[model samples]
Target: MAELLKAGAVFFVGFLALYLLIVLVVWLGQERMIFQGHVLPQHYAFSFKADFEEYSIPAADGAILNALLFRSDSSSRGVVLYLHGNRGNLSRWGHMHRPFTQRGYDVLLIDYRGYGKSTGKPTESGLYQDGEAALQWLLQYYEARKIIIYGRSLGSGVAAYLAARNPHQLLILETPYDALTNVIQHQALLPLPGCIFRHHFPTYRYLPAAEGPIYILAGSHDRLIPLYLSKRLQPLIGTPENFKVIQGAGHRNLAAFQAYHFELDRLLLP
Candidate 1:
């Protein structure tokens, strides 16, 4: 009996040590989990130039978020609220600015919390809050124009949640995962209990509620999120007609795809 109790104690200690180690690693790698690396300053050298304005909008949670507003010289029919991927800031999105501007659509690129010069640490809830704040800012400023929410990678979850609640807006999701739990399960290779993670974005739960003109874009060679995940979301998202899969494109090289630019132009053009 004493030997059995001793063995149990030893097992308990081992389990506790492992749990603590995992917690430490997760805490240390939180920023790394979201942003890939430090975002360098970007200079837009595109042939077409748009009038750019920098703005800082206050979030509902009192965090100040930075954004770049690009307005075309021509008539503006609508605004594109661009929520970028996990890593990098609005500067990384400068490359795509010309396409939208050339199409006569205003582009608003935002930096979520802990991204670029935005304040506060990045949490899943915080990113959602940032998305809401950005949408609200546009509604206040561009009340007459149509608002389109464009999300890429991690931002897809944020855009999904917003679209679910407010169906009047247009939603364009690029290389999005089914849910936060799905991403953690597949990418982190952790067990099912990892669903208890505090930062779970849970986009899958919100898909059924989305009632808008939805557009889905995925890459055939996207190994990170995988093509199957996006394909799985098709039925759940009200059978979207704008689903597109770009050939020869991976997770990181989405910008290299001519199809990406073509789709954006086609979508923005009236």
Candidate 2:
């Protein structure tokens, strides 16, 4: 009986140690996992077909944020301040702005810190500052009512943060989560304490105070950020009806679907 008890205690201790090690590793490396930015050379020239003017916006903390201002072929209606996902630089994401630019709205896409030519490392707070700097730069030429804030995936939190603090024409979040904590917990193998995460986006907290029309787009088959997680954010919007679902679309492929364009047309086009 004594031997059996000792063996059981040893096995429990070993399992506990392994679990703690996993937690420590995850906690230490969560930033890399969350912000998967692709760095670019300082002098890398962008070769997009669209008419774009690139600029290096200055962040409050001395970070240089690289951005592209894509001018519309037709007369400008407004500008979409597009905050992109956690992966890739503006070169990869610039092509995704056709939906807005082709429809006569100029698109401004900024690379988060450590992404593209943007200097400094990325942090949740740093991204918010980067977004504010972008908006301030835009305000020099365009009125607040002419700026539409759009967030995608990881950028959703940044968009929400910006919208909550600034006045804009509209706020759009694609494949967003209620909170970063909720997303981390949902994707974890085993249940994890919320304290383990350093960045808690808390879009739900920002969405309530955001000015202007708030619209959320969700892909029916988004495995990265599931439909239900996006649905959880519907109640935060003043008009929950603005919550749009693109059927047959997944996280990254929503732009390929006709339904995605249809929804954008309904919301954006004259």
Candidate 3:
């Protein structure tokens, strides 16, 4: 009996130490988990186009952020401030603006501080500053009502943060998680205490104060973030009717489907 108790105590101590170690790892590397920016060298000249104008918006921390203003030839409905996901730079993401620009809505796609031709590192608070700076830069060229904020994946958090603070024509979020806290907890394989995270992009908290029509687009089969997370956020913005589920769509391939365009029409057109 004594031997069994000793073994049990040793096992308990080992498990406890391992659990604490995991918590420590989460604390040290949470930023990497949240942000996956593909950085570019400073002053990297973006390719010029006939209709596009590249920008180097200044941030509070002296970071030169990279962005592009994709112009629409037809009568402009508004400009979409396109905030992309956690991964990749504007070079790859620029292709996505066609869905908006082809429909006469210009696109303003920007990279987070470290991504694309932008300089400086990425932080949650700093991203909010970058987002605001982008919005202010856009407002300089167009009226406040002519700007529509669109965020997908990680960018949705930044978009929600911006829309909550600024006035815009509309706020469209695609495949957005409820909060960074929720995302960490949901993705945690074990029942770990992921609630004490540092990077809290509280989209649910921001949506309440946002001044625009909030259109939430979620995928029916998104494994990275479940569809119900988007459903949960709908009540915070408006009725469940505002939550539009694009069938057969996942997190990354949402733009590849025609249903994605259909929903954009619902928000962009009357």
What C-alpha lDDT do the candidate models reach, one value each? 0.77, 0.92, 0.85
lDDT per residue (tens digit) for residues 34-66 in model 2: 899999999899998877899999999999999
Runs in model 1 deviating more than 4 A are 1-31, 35-50, 190-192
Best by TM-score: 2
TM-score of 2: 0.94
RMSD of candidate 2 to true structure, Å: 1.8
- What's the ranking of the predictions by TM-score, best on top? 2, 3, 1
What candidate 2 gets wrong by more than 4 Å, as runs, is: 1-15
- Candidate 1 achieves a global lDDT of 0.77
TM-score of each: 0.82, 0.94, 0.90
lDDT of 3 at 22: 73
Instruction: List pairs with backbone clashes in candidate 2.
Output: none
Against the true structure, candidate 1 reaches a TM-score of 0.82
Residue 11 of model 3, lDDT score: 100
Higher-scoring candidate on TM-score, 1 or 2: 2
Q: Candidate 3 residues 57-172, lDDT tens each?
A: 99877888888888888888889999999888987788777888888889998898888788778888988989999999999888999999999988899999999999899888
